[model samples]
Target: MSEKAMTDIRNDPAAATRHDIALSIDKVRGVLEALRFGSITLTVHDARVVQIDVTEKTRLHA
Candidate 1:
């Protein structure tokens, strides 16, 4: 998502709804999985996503 788009969503009052927050979390998880990430931690404050921590595993090639 573009920075402006994200900013728009974050600034939207409807984005704080439980359904919207859940959808956002699911989307983030899907992106991480698609990128083969090891784990992701989402920090939510005031029902908004404040921070995200992603751990990616590096594959070793012989």
Candidate 2:
């Protein structure tokens, strides 16, 4: 992320209100596409996602 982008996210109150659902969804989408073998967990409270957890696994071939 660029410094300008970081500043923009911080400066725009609407972009960050309630943990920024749009941004969270975009991030989740990206993670979903990139992950092959992993678990995506969303921690929510009051119908809002508060945290995201990504656990990736490595499989060894015999």
Candidate 3:
């Protein structure tokens, strides 16, 4: 398995907040096709995606 992205989920603050869900699926086909290498980072708040970041992967052989 490989580390695809970094996820940071935080609680939401609302006066009438009842419930919140957290989940997201990114269309990596484009990214993979474009760069052919990178990483992904996803941030969510109150079950909503807030941020996303992509970088290069680092692999080492033993």
* TM-score per model over all chains: 0.48, 0.61, 0.37
Q: Which window of ten consecutive residues has the lowest lDDT sum in model 2?
A: 14-23
Stretches > 4 Å off in candidate 1: 1-16
Please list the C-alpha lDDT of all candidates, in the order they appear.
Answer: 0.74, 0.82, 0.48
* Candidate 2 positional error at 16, Å: 9.0
* Candidate 2 structure quality by residue, lDDT tens digits, 1-62: 78886787799876556347877798899989999997999998866677989999999899
Error of 3 at 6 (Å): 31
**lDDT score, residue 59, model 3?**
71
The residue-by-residue lDDT of candidate 1 on 1-62, one tens digit each, is 67876777788767537557787778797767677737778888977777777788888889
- Candidate 3 Cα outliers beyond 4 Å, as residue runs: 1-29, 57-62
**TM-score for predicted model 2 compared with the true structure:** 0.61
Winning model by lDDT? 2
The RMSD of every model to the true structure, in order and in angstroms, is: 6.4, 5.1, 13.0
